[model samples]
Target: MTLTLPPAPHGGPRAGRHLVDAALWPDVARLPRASALRTAVARRIVERAVRRLPLRVRTPGAAAPALPRQPRGSADGLPTLILHDPGAFFRRIGADGLIGFGESYMAGEWDGDDLVGVLTVLAGHVDDLVPQALRRLRGAWVHRRPASDRNTVDGARRNVHRHYDLSNELFATFLDPTLTYSSAVFASLPAGAEDLSAAQHRKIDRLLDLAGTGPGTTLLEIGTGWGELAVRAARRGARVRTVTLSREQRDLALRRVAEAGLRDRVTVELCDYRRVDGTYDAVVSVEMIEAVGAAYWPAYFGALHRLLAPGGRAVLQAITMPHERMLHTARTHTWISKYVFPGGLVPSREAIARHSAAAGLSLVHDTGYGEHYAETLRLWRERFLGRSAEVSALGFDHVFRRMWELYLAYSEAGFRSRYLDVRQLVLTGRTTADRGTG
Candidate 1:
């Protein structure tokens, strides 16, 4: 059923005073104190780890009572780390490990002269931060994925609501006019904010092209992100059916489809992909696989295989990590998983290939554009920071803003350091004759 919602003032939900009470926006001001021994150990480990890296860790007035001796690292031409509250930083890291590091930043305990650069250097050396002996015992100390973040149907809906159902104005402040939340494949390596809309269209068109979308073609989109892809497909003369779990996205997407006068050609449903039933000439899902969770990857791939008609194709744009790294951290919960996108895990290219092949889908084409994602995030971060007042007016506090800023910068650094990737993949069904060879 098409659920109708009264449009907000600007074609979205009422933005102001809605997100301040969001569950993800945790209060960072009140935290449990760490024992003195734990704090001392954390401070020592942090100082030793950063000592040989390209970082300049310092406190105000050249010295402070909390941090008596500043570490002398390879600081020439490196990013400077300014510690506002050294005691809090130590306590947080000592207690929560990496999650605490991110929380410390959100709590205003530290600031960096070059946020992305600092994160990039740290990301490059992430696997080496701890000693080999301690690394082997990570499972004992690291946070485990919570049972609630399991990505079951109910859990998935709740997780999606936690992030995507936040005020739409919050996303509109940073994203392009189309409201695309994924990475844009730009024609040039680094495009300006003015070019983001065109880049997003370009990205969508490429996926459509891979899907062979055209007149009279039946296109099914697994993720309906603001209805831009549906509108574009409808304009190309294709019949489009797109589904999303987000109510906010569905409401705005329906409004956008109407605004474009393509309501007859496009159908937007507030449904999950697994619940949709149809045979289409093409299926396209952009950057949605990350939220499928590793355990459900096979089910996700099987759904794509089952929904395609004869000679049909499925295209996906996914954020990926190294296969070994993905396996190592598959069950571990990090700050991003906790604060930004719950129940999310980026799959590896190999994992995608293996899962789809098992589901009778043949991998056809794969393209990586991590640099484009890096550039895309840089533009978003700058735009988001520039519009701080507007974001604040939307009822988000400084801690929420800091957490979001850190999320963007952390992701950008992952791409910049080659620790993360974004890829486009095309898959086709396997014929009975072809299935015998494997």
Candidate 2:
């Protein structure tokens, strides 16, 4: 049934209301609610997990018993989690597991002093949080992704618009002045030491360099992120064609290209990567592979293989997870999928190699910089928090703020704990014979 919400106050849906797709309504309506017994069990499991970690948990009342403390270390201090409403927190966890945990935070049931650090400890111990017997029955607890979230041509557009089109103004508030939205290749441990713009340029330059883009080089960018990469490539004397599903991004990118006086050199199209045509001397897509759900990984790689001219090289920056974890969570719907990026999955390094190889591309170079991503998220989260008033002025509510905070902090934790990574991959053409023999 269609959820006929009163149209949003503005032109588009509000921050948390993006799940307005009629096809997704049924799934939302059917979300499971935990029983009292299940809630009690979940509380015990959470308490057990908390006890094993180097974290501090404070309950609601002054007389309430707090969690055990950890010894001082080189780190700033022990991370702290304060459960403002312990009952709601555990009930949500029992109902939706991790997804509920995020909702509980958004509902102001809990908070963390060092959100990223606390989340990192939790991420590091994800495997041991639950007992072996319970782990085997994960299917009973975890919510599978609904079929409506699949990245079909039409579905992909909806998913992309849901996040990317949330308002360019909103993204600009957190992203660097350049509006680059992916991990930057920082020259230092902390991101802001050399300025984010320089680091972003370094990352883009590295990808272009690996693709051998130069004067008269024809470059095809699969994901046009505000035209930063295209502008940089055009400045390198390469004619660039970039594609994106975001109308907001395409319009802004075109204006940026025009402002740079590179309109003749750069073309930004509102199109999907799968539908892009014509061969190019080089291809570069930054951190886009993660959005191409695992079911479409083969098609995504095949598009790259089909789009490259003979001897042409392609460069991709991808966010990845361990193979086992990727496999285990590939179809599980979690907090990120529910509240932030929909219809996306982080691919594993092994999955990247296997899929790219099968698509007749040889992996020439691969580099992982997960720590850089951690630093990048820290910068973004801080910037976003600093501009909370502006974010609210733009129409997002308190719940939206908390949700975005959890999303960014949760992502940073994934990288900090080494549960996730960002990788730059360089691919070269392979002969049909080579693929067949392999």
Instruction: List the global CA lDDT of all models.
Output: 0.83, 0.84
Model 1: lowest-lDDT 10 consecutive positions: 1-10
lDDT at 71 for candidate 2?
40
lDDT of 1 at 245: 94
The sequence of per-residue lDDT tens digits that candidate 1 reaches over residues 1-438 is 111111112222221223334454453554445786766666766666676566566665543222223345433466767766666677677777778888778877678899898899789878887777667657644689898998899999999999999989999999989899999888877574348898889999999999999999999999898989999999999999999999999999999999999999999998877888978989999999999999999889999988888788999999999898898778788898999889999999999999999998999899999999999899899989999999999988877898999999999999999999999999998454543343
The candidate that wins on lDDT is 2
How much lDDT does candidate 2 score? 0.84
TM-score of each: 0.89, 0.90
For model 1, give the RMSD to the true fold: 10.0
